[model samples]
Target chain A: MDLRDKYGLLIDDMADMRATVRIQLADGGLEKCDQARNVKEAVQKLSLRRYDLIVCDYNLGQGADGQQLLELLRRRQILPLTTAFLIITGETSYEQVATAAEYAPDDYLLKPFTADALRTRLTRILEKKEALAPLYRHLGPKGDPVQALAVCDELLAQGSRYSLDILRHKGELLQTLNRSQEALALYEGVLQQRATPWATVGKARVLAAGGDDTAAKEQLAGALKAYPNYLAAYDSLAAILEKTDTEAAQAVMEQSLAVAPTTQRQRRVGALALENEDYVRAEEAFKRAVEKDRTGFFKSHDDYAGLARSYSAQGKVQEALATVKDMSQYFAASPALTARQAAVESQVYAKAGNAEAAKAALQKALQTRQGGDLDPATQLEIAQACFTSGSAEQAKDIIRNLAEDHHENDQVLAEAQKVFARAGLGDEGGVFLDATRKRMVKLNNDAVALAKAGELDQAIAMLTEAADRLRNNCQVAINAALALLMNIHRKGMDTSALARAHHYILQARHANPEHPRLEEVASFYRKVAPPGTLILDDE
Target chain B: MDTLLATVIHDAKNGLATLGAWLEQARAQTPSPALEEACRQAQRINTQLVELLALHRGSEGTLRLAIADHDLADFVDDLKAEWLAPPQSTITVSWPADAGRIGAWAFDAYQVKLVLLDVLRNALRHARTTVALRLAVEPGGGIRFTVQDDGPGFPVAHSATMHDQGSGLGLSFARLIAREHRTPNGKHGDIEMKNAPQGGALFSLILP
Candidate 1:
């Protein structure tokens, strides 16, 4: 309960408020506290050294707030799970501070609190954090969820006072590990005792993951009615509805936006509205997302691209072109920005019947292809532009390559399908994407079969070629590494093969760190390679 | 109009909270009865402003509760910390022992804590020697919080019409919050006030 040893950070824009809270923090026995006047300084301080606690004022005087700061830190993994974050807010902003569903602070205090109250809250949160340290040690960005689940079991068996908190983590880990039935049972057990919002939304998530979309939708609908401020339910419902009904999904996103108009949620609504051909709504959503944050930390290239495309769909060619131009000014110079802007410009010009200019922009976008992989969205934009410029063959080539590289990723494949749909080839796009996915699957299966039949060399050759071509495909890279390791296991270590295996393992980790099979493959390399071989970064 | 009213009330509430904190600091440094009374009054006004703003939002149909799971023991400890005993009174407050055993429940902790604090303060005014708060699982479903004080029970007329009580705003706000807590099965929370069989006033807030 002692705060004397804990390092703390206090963030507030007002110097007076910062001084007041500093005195309070010292009075509360926390002497080693740093001060940050703004979000930029806070991020810098966090990157330099770790803190045991952070007390941030909700109103940071710019477009940024504590909630956004928390989201930024969490998304970038700049803040570890061990650090306790507490938000201080006035009554006017407490609802917003309280209902921050994802990346919520460890605790929040209403402003005007005495030092005694502050110390009490700090002690309570730190005690809970200390009790759950073992579970959290395996929970965040680099932690193993499998090990975290085991820790949850141990704590639960010991009758930990924070059993409810532990159970919440356990259910999420279960879902992440793809154990739907167990997660569903866990949620149901909690619900039998009380109708908690997390358990209600969690049960719906399990239903959705289990592919019972109807039941999931019904559960989410009921949950929203009871807990209308629950953002997670809206997000889950929209994700499920997006596959079958874009219009309904857009509605859900709009409702969530009404509750909390976060730039991320606004971008999601814009994208969904664009898909549903609600061009005006899309334009509004995207405009809000782009203009809401003057700091430019939360705005993404996707928002400007979405805004421009929506303008183009509504035949506002000048406005669309202006938005595309403005996007480059907001973001730093990068190949992704170059590709996204040019591709969006091509779409706008093509819509306005300027074929020559459209083709020129499309060529410029394609030139960025040699600079290495553009993001999936930018690539999709380029393909859509290609389809608009009377190059169906070129467009299909782009989609095919993307599909093969990310065959396991349904989200990317769905985006590819949307590109085809926008090109007036919905059914044909579905069939084409399906065939490409099947081909990628067959390639992996054939290589694995060869390896099993004692043809390690052939398997290695096939998988290595595919993995080399599809650098972003973690599955192929993992299989390639496994094949190399298996060969070394059978024929003893060849340094060349060992080096290639190490390369593919690192490539797979870079592509997708949380791939379920990543640990197994990495451990295999560790076992087969001789001592003092290449060390895995994760280890 | 609603936005303007709510904003003004919110600002006033925040100002009063700051005043209360300052008064508390002065009381701690100087140790005066007058500063103690000023702190109590400042907190009262702050609580009233919070209630008024919430009522304004309720009338505008914009009131939404941020219901989440909160550990009962932590919540009770928070309430105990925030509760300011009446000036020059020897009355003691008792908290529930089974809060940890009850584990956690879903409710808007901020508003609920305010409601319980108001109820406890009211009980302190009426209690002869002791006031106690207890937690239990409500019959049928949900969680219940009871505030009991060993004082003269509410008169028969006032028991039915709580408006006869001091200001009447606290009870109205408490009722509004309790009813706002609901379940997927269509059950809603409620507030009940009555004379306890043990010759004391008992108030309970049940949340689903």
Candidate 2:
């Protein structure tokens, strides 16, 4: 009696689940299974336990529909390999939506289907999934990527029924291993089978990584031309061009946003347009992103800040101020984000012609940056605000430091050029950029020469001195780490030198995680020094 | 006449599907031969209703399909399982081995399933012993789905007689489905009904 009272609702839910999966066999026989009634309950059940199959209805009454739920499950990697997720749709529109999704359901069942129909389809899907289960099992919760590569190779060689799937998996695994060459060959093989957009995108990425930008660009352009709505081609193409051709990147981004305007894509397009200095487009994009991405986990204060910048640039000072006020409401007060917000606020004030208020806000922004080590991007942001407020000396100092530190970094140099161009010091800024870059290169070269000449300690000493002198310059810091590693190789693990090596590599990594040389140098630390050091093991 | 026919068929389909759903649900809770009979009969009615509606629309040139892609073997299995009860041990599915890699082809998977269901139902009902559903890639470039049965061939005036009651109209609907399957190479699909050389009724949807 108490069980009924406690679990009456649960029993009802179980019954609903049973009905969802109660597919008909021939002669009106029912095969028993379970499914949740709605997306919330489905996600809940899925997270708690993995079912062998899920048959979801397209119209789930309200909230997220089946396709959206399926997308979420795939994106979050919540669905198990053994599970077959099928979406049942009563309308043709759901079919189009399912097809358009990057991660679609295993199969879609049209409505008014008999139970036998569903059972047959489900059986076929489950059998296929079973055949590929070994590959799936290897890539599961406790899986290792290195070991998974071996599994991929074994399955690939054996040539199972899932040979094609295994090949795709191997290609992806190879890419993850940073072995782009092998991945490129596999992707090319797949493209020969079918000009699948995903395979093309993979080929483009491998090409881009290998420094064949022109070929990568041609491949990406062909895919986009064939399937204009394929978001991966647009995104990968935009990402490559974002470094060198901001305007083209922004244009491709806008085209992609038209196909499927996800909030994440919207924020990306906004940032890119802002980078390209297309204020009108940036304002609309950021506003759209902010409106839709309020609850999005990927949403950041940068979205609101970008919107405010666009608004202020367009001379809509009130809207810019309001955008900042809204940003504060969305995010908690952190020193870094707070500082960025104050800088945006000063820009709004300057646009409104409030000299005194702008100066005060600029001072507040500077105070926020004084105690903390602001990132180069943040430094640039604050510097832009300082320049707008006519604090020429402070603005020039910030840009000079940023320019000297990251003169060779494409992303930083591009942004730095914009800053210099905006301040009407365009040609002078180019000359300054050259001089600073030359000086750093000379120092780096001198240190490396000392290391090569077998004066390892002197090289290490010189680099460390230069690292201290030129703060936040990752190129110098990375060189300094290399010198220290060479010193270790020569002197045999001097604790002090090992410690210094750790300090600089960590600093370099923290400065720019995307640096190509980062993992290369850090791997050497593990080779020379013994295990149990935090630096070697931490990596 | 067309308006009345469409309205009645549409309503009947809705009723039959609703009936089929409830009966299937009831059978799951407490299954019986009687409930299964009711469900099967309701399915037949639903199939007839869908056929009538589609045939009428085809005649008026109002029929449109949500053409998408589906795996051929899976599609055949679904038809076999749904339309054949005891699923007939005599009934088997065959396709050229390499045609298995045909993987997925563009078609109106659901509606085409309906057309094949009707054709297969007739074959199963009439077959003496065996019903074979064979899939083969046509010599030129298209795919063919054929339902053959060792059954007494149709009467000489079959279409003339069956057309009166909209039974032959089902064939017309099947033909319409084939024609709607337009390929990028600008070829339209076709359907043929003929007596097999080895003594059987032959029905095929030749799709580009």
Candidate maximizing TM-score: 1
Each model's total of backbone clashes = 0, 2
lDDT of 1 by residue, B1-208 (tens): 3599987887787677677778878888999878877877887887888888778787887788888889998899888888777767899999998898889899999999999998998888788999999999976889899999999978777674452256788888999999989887688899998889889899999999
The alpha-carbon RMSD values of the candidates against the true structure, listed in the order shown, are 2.1, 8.1
Q: Which one is best on DockQ?
A: 1
lDDT of 2: 0.71
DockQ of 2: 0.13
Could you tell me how far off, in angstroms, the CA of residue A215 lies in candidate 1 after the best superposition? 0.9
Per-residue lDDT for A487 in model 2? Answer: 72
- Candidate 2 collision pairs: A24-A115, A24-A116
Query: What digit string (tens of lDDT, one per residue) describes model 2 on residues B43-130?
Result: 7776667766767776885555544445665666566555554422465534334445666565667788888777777777677777
Instruction: Extract clashing residue pairs from model 1.
Output: none
- Which stretches in model 1 have alpha-carbon errors above 4 Å? A100-102, B11-35, B162-164
Judge the docking of candidate 1 as incorrect, acceptable, medium or high.
medium
Q: Write down the C-alpha DockQ for each prediction.
A: 0.69, 0.13
lDDT of 1 by residue, A344-454 (tens): 899899999999999999999999976898878889989999999989999999988889989988899999999999899999999999999999999999999999999
